[model samples]
Target: MDVFDHDAGGISGRRPLVEIEEGAGFPDGLTVDAEGCVWVALWDGGAVRRYTPAGELDRVVTLPTPRTTACAFGGPGLTDLYVTTARTGLASPHPLSGSLLVVPGAGKGLPQPAFEG
Candidate 1:
Protein backbone atom coordinates (compact mmCIF):
# COMPACT_ATOMS: atom_id res chain seq x y z
CA MET A 1 0.00 0.00 0.00
CA ASP A 2 1.06 3.63 -0.57
CA VAL A 3 1.47 6.02 2.29
CA PHE A 4 0.31 9.49 1.48
CA ASP A 5 1.66 12.65 3.01
CA HIS A 6 -0.68 13.89 5.73
CA ASP A 7 -0.86 17.44 4.46
CA ALA A 8 -2.97 19.45 2.06
CA GLY A 9 -5.61 16.75 2.06
CA GLY A 10 -2.90 14.08 1.60
CA ILE A 11 -2.67 15.02 -2.06
CA SER A 12 1.10 14.98 -2.18
CA GLY A 13 4.13 12.96 -1.10
CA ARG A 14 2.81 9.61 -2.03
CA ARG A 15 5.30 6.80 -1.45
CA PRO A 16 5.30 3.06 -1.73
CA LEU A 17 5.02 1.32 1.61
CA VAL A 18 5.02 -2.22 0.31
CA GLU A 19 4.67 -4.18 -2.88
CA ILE A 20 3.21 -7.67 -3.31
CA GLU A 21 3.80 -9.78 -6.38
CA GLU A 22 0.83 -10.29 -8.68
CA GLY A 23 1.25 -14.04 -8.58
CA ALA A 24 1.28 -14.07 -4.80
CA GLY A 25 -2.40 -13.29 -4.52
CA PHE A 26 -3.92 -9.88 -3.87
CA PRO A 27 -3.64 -7.99 -0.63
CA ASP A 28 -7.07 -7.80 0.90
CA GLY A 29 -7.99 -6.84 4.45
CA LEU A 30 -5.36 -5.05 6.56
CA THR A 31 -4.95 -3.79 10.09
CA VAL A 32 -2.22 -2.21 12.20
CA ASP A 33 -1.02 -3.65 15.45
CA ALA A 34 -0.35 -1.78 18.63
CA GLU A 35 3.35 -1.85 17.81
CA GLY A 36 2.77 -0.16 14.45
CA CYS A 37 3.18 -3.25 12.33
CA VAL A 38 0.82 -4.14 9.50
CA TRP A 39 -1.13 -7.38 9.20
CA VAL A 40 -2.41 -8.13 5.74
CA ALA A 41 -4.59 -10.96 4.49
CA LEU A 42 -3.74 -12.43 1.11
CA TRP A 43 -6.84 -13.24 -0.87
CA ASP A 44 -6.56 -16.46 -2.87
CA GLY A 45 -3.12 -17.03 -1.31
CA GLY A 46 -4.17 -18.88 1.81
CA ALA A 47 -2.04 -16.86 4.16
CA VAL A 48 -1.64 -13.78 6.26
CA ARG A 49 1.51 -11.68 6.29
CA ARG A 50 2.86 -9.27 8.82
CA TYR A 51 5.16 -6.39 7.91
CA THR A 52 7.18 -4.12 10.09
CA PRO A 53 6.84 -0.40 10.04
CA ALA A 54 9.88 -0.20 7.78
CA GLY A 55 8.12 -2.33 5.15
CA GLU A 56 9.98 -5.50 6.00
CA LEU A 57 8.24 -8.87 5.94
CA ASP A 58 8.10 -9.96 9.53
CA ARG A 59 5.90 -13.04 9.63
CA VAL A 60 3.57 -15.25 7.66
CA VAL A 61 0.65 -17.29 8.95
CA THR A 62 -0.84 -19.86 6.61
CA LEU A 63 -4.46 -20.84 6.65
CA PRO A 64 -6.19 -24.06 5.72
CA THR A 65 -8.26 -22.32 3.07
CA PRO A 66 -7.72 -19.78 0.35
CA ARG A 67 -9.98 -16.78 -0.23
CA THR A 68 -8.99 -15.22 3.04
CA THR A 69 -11.03 -12.09 3.06
CA ALA A 70 -10.53 -10.07 6.25
CA CYS A 71 -8.89 -10.15 9.68
CA ALA A 72 -9.11 -8.43 13.03
CA PHE A 73 -7.83 -8.79 16.58
CA GLY A 74 -10.03 -10.01 19.40
CA GLY A 75 -10.15 -12.15 22.54
CA PRO A 76 -9.21 -11.11 26.06
CA GLY A 77 -5.87 -9.52 25.28
CA LEU A 78 -6.70 -8.57 21.72
CA THR A 79 -4.00 -10.97 20.59
CA ASP A 80 -6.21 -13.44 18.80
CA LEU A 81 -6.45 -13.00 15.04
CA TYR A 82 -10.00 -13.48 13.82
CA VAL A 83 -9.84 -14.29 10.13
CA THR A 84 -12.83 -14.32 7.84
CA THR A 85 -12.97 -16.42 4.71
CA ALA A 86 -15.17 -16.54 1.65
CA ARG A 87 -16.46 -19.54 -0.31
CA THR A 88 -18.28 -17.58 -2.97
CA GLY A 89 -17.57 -18.42 -6.61
CA LEU A 90 -16.01 -21.69 -5.70
CA ALA A 91 -17.27 -24.87 -7.26
CA SER A 92 -16.16 -27.01 -4.34
CA PRO A 93 -15.37 -25.14 -1.17
CA HIS A 94 -12.85 -26.21 1.37
CA PRO A 95 -14.04 -27.51 4.71
CA LEU A 96 -12.94 -24.36 6.46
CA SER A 97 -14.25 -22.00 3.83
CA GLY A 98 -16.60 -19.29 5.00
CA SER A 99 -15.50 -19.87 8.55
CA LEU A 100 -14.17 -17.61 11.25
CA LEU A 101 -10.72 -18.93 11.95
CA VAL A 102 -8.96 -17.69 15.01
CA VAL A 103 -5.25 -17.76 15.50
CA PRO A 104 -4.21 -17.51 19.08
CA GLY A 105 -1.42 -15.13 20.06
CA ALA A 106 -1.23 -13.39 16.74
CA GLY A 107 -0.55 -9.88 17.99
CA LYS A 108 -1.91 -7.03 19.99
CA GLY A 109 -4.36 -4.63 18.41
CA LEU A 110 -4.64 -0.90 18.81
CA PRO A 111 -7.06 0.27 21.44
CA GLN A 112 -10.43 1.10 20.10
CA PRO A 113 -11.40 4.73 20.02
CA ALA A 114 -14.81 5.81 21.20
CA PHE A 115 -17.11 7.78 18.98
CA GLU A 116 -20.45 9.25 19.98
CA GLY A 117 -22.36 11.21 17.44
Candidate 2:
Protein backbone atom coordinates (compact mmCIF):
# COMPACT_ATOMS: atom_id res chain seq x y z
CA MET A 1 0.00 0.00 0.00
CA ASP A 2 1.01 3.66 -0.40
CA VAL A 3 1.07 6.22 2.39
CA PHE A 4 0.22 9.80 1.51
CA ASP A 5 1.01 13.01 3.32
CA HIS A 6 -1.89 15.42 3.40
CA ASP A 7 -1.37 19.15 3.40
CA ALA A 8 -3.15 22.37 2.50
CA GLY A 9 -2.56 21.51 -1.13
CA GLY A 10 -4.11 18.10 -0.65
CA ILE A 11 -2.06 14.96 -0.87
CA SER A 12 1.52 16.13 -1.08
CA GLY A 13 3.17 12.88 -2.09
CA ARG A 14 3.04 9.14 -1.70
CA ARG A 15 5.54 6.80 -0.15
CA PRO A 16 5.57 3.08 -0.76
CA LEU A 17 4.87 1.25 2.48
CA VAL A 18 4.13 -2.38 3.26
CA GLU A 19 3.48 -4.75 0.41
CA ILE A 20 1.51 -7.91 1.15
CA GLU A 21 2.77 -11.08 -0.40
CA GLU A 22 0.79 -12.72 -3.18
CA GLY A 23 -0.81 -15.36 -0.97
CA ALA A 24 -1.21 -13.23 2.12
CA GLY A 25 -4.69 -11.95 2.84
CA PHE A 26 -5.58 -8.36 2.01
CA PRO A 27 -5.24 -5.66 4.62
CA ASP A 28 -8.71 -4.69 5.75
CA GLY A 29 -8.36 -2.19 8.61
CA LEU A 30 -5.54 -0.70 10.67
CA THR A 31 -4.69 1.54 13.60
CA VAL A 32 -1.55 3.32 14.68
CA ASP A 33 -0.35 2.94 18.23
CA ALA A 34 0.95 5.71 20.50
CA GLU A 35 4.47 4.61 19.70
CA GLY A 36 3.80 5.23 15.98
CA CYS A 37 3.76 1.55 15.09
CA VAL A 38 1.01 0.33 12.78
CA TRP A 39 -1.29 -2.58 13.64
CA VAL A 40 -2.89 -4.10 10.58
CA ALA A 41 -5.64 -6.69 10.36
CA LEU A 42 -5.03 -9.32 7.74
CA TRP A 43 -8.23 -10.47 6.12
CA ASP A 44 -8.23 -14.22 5.48
CA GLY A 45 -4.74 -14.45 6.95
CA GLY A 46 -5.86 -15.20 10.46
CA ALA A 47 -3.49 -12.73 12.04
CA VAL A 48 -2.64 -9.14 12.89
CA ARG A 49 0.73 -7.71 12.13
CA ARG A 50 2.51 -4.86 13.81
CA TYR A 51 4.78 -2.81 11.60
CA THR A 52 7.23 -0.12 12.45
CA PRO A 53 6.80 3.39 11.08
CA ALA A 54 9.42 2.52 8.48
CA GLY A 55 7.18 -0.32 7.18
CA GLU A 56 9.18 -3.08 8.73
CA LEU A 57 7.23 -5.95 10.25
CA ASP A 58 7.80 -6.10 13.99
CA ARG A 59 5.44 -8.76 15.25
CA VAL A 60 2.43 -10.89 14.41
CA VAL A 61 -0.57 -12.03 16.44
CA THR A 62 -2.33 -15.04 15.07
CA LEU A 63 -6.03 -15.58 15.58
CA PRO A 64 -8.24 -18.65 15.51
CA THR A 65 -10.21 -17.50 12.53
CA PRO A 66 -8.92 -16.72 9.06
CA ARG A 67 -11.34 -13.90 8.33
CA THR A 68 -10.14 -11.14 10.61
CA THR A 69 -11.37 -7.88 9.18
CA ALA A 70 -10.54 -5.01 11.54
CA CYS A 71 -8.97 -4.09 14.86
CA ALA A 72 -8.89 -1.22 17.33
CA PHE A 73 -7.59 -0.49 20.81
CA GLY A 74 -10.09 -0.15 23.60
CA GLY A 75 -10.49 -0.87 27.31
CA PRO A 76 -9.67 1.44 30.22
CA GLY A 77 -6.00 1.71 29.40
CA LEU A 78 -6.45 1.47 25.60
CA THR A 79 -4.13 -1.49 25.71
CA ASP A 80 -6.61 -4.04 24.45
CA LEU A 81 -6.80 -4.90 20.79
CA TYR A 82 -10.34 -5.66 19.74
CA VAL A 83 -10.70 -7.50 16.46
CA THR A 84 -13.63 -8.16 14.15
CA THR A 85 -14.01 -10.99 11.70
CA ALA A 86 -16.37 -12.20 9.01
CA ARG A 87 -17.93 -15.55 8.08
CA THR A 88 -19.35 -14.87 4.65
CA GLY A 89 -18.08 -17.06 1.82
CA LEU A 90 -16.44 -19.52 4.16
CA ALA A 91 -16.74 -23.05 2.87
CA SER A 92 -16.98 -24.35 6.40
CA PRO A 93 -18.11 -22.84 9.65
CA HIS A 94 -15.50 -21.40 11.96
CA PRO A 95 -16.21 -21.11 15.66
CA LEU A 96 -14.51 -17.76 15.99
CA SER A 97 -15.64 -16.33 12.71
CA GLY A 98 -18.01 -13.39 13.03
CA SER A 99 -17.00 -13.01 16.64
CA LEU A 100 -15.31 -10.19 18.46
CA LEU A 101 -11.96 -11.06 19.98
CA VAL A 102 -9.93 -9.04 22.42
CA VAL A 103 -6.24 -9.27 23.11
CA PRO A 104 -5.21 -7.66 26.34
CA GLY A 105 -1.92 -5.83 26.74
CA ALA A 106 -1.42 -5.59 23.00
CA GLY A 107 -0.16 -2.04 23.37
CA LYS A 108 -1.32 1.42 24.22
CA GLY A 109 -3.05 3.28 21.44
CA LEU A 110 -3.05 6.98 20.92
CA PRO A 111 -6.33 8.78 21.30
CA GLN A 112 -7.64 9.78 17.93
CA PRO A 113 -6.71 13.40 17.45
CA ALA A 114 -9.36 15.97 16.72
CA PHE A 115 -9.36 17.58 13.33
CA GLU A 116 -9.62 21.35 13.12
CA GLY A 117 -10.71 21.18 9.54
| Each model's backbone clash number | 0, 0
Q: Would you estimate the TM-scores of all the predictions?
A: 0.90, 0.91
Can you write out model 1's per-residue Cα lDDT over 11-89, one digit (the tens) per residue? Answer: 7778998999787778999889999988999999998999998999999999988899888898998999999999988
Q: What are the root-mean-square deviations of the candidates from the true structure over C-alphas?
A: 1.7, 2.2
lDDT of 2 by residue, 1-117 (tens): 679899787996798889989777889999999999889999989999999989999989999999999999999889999999999999995888999999999999878767999
Worst 10 residues of 1 by lDDT: 2-11
- Candidate 1 deviates by what RMSD? 1.7
Best by TM-score: 2
In terms of lDDT, which candidate is strongest?
Answer: 2
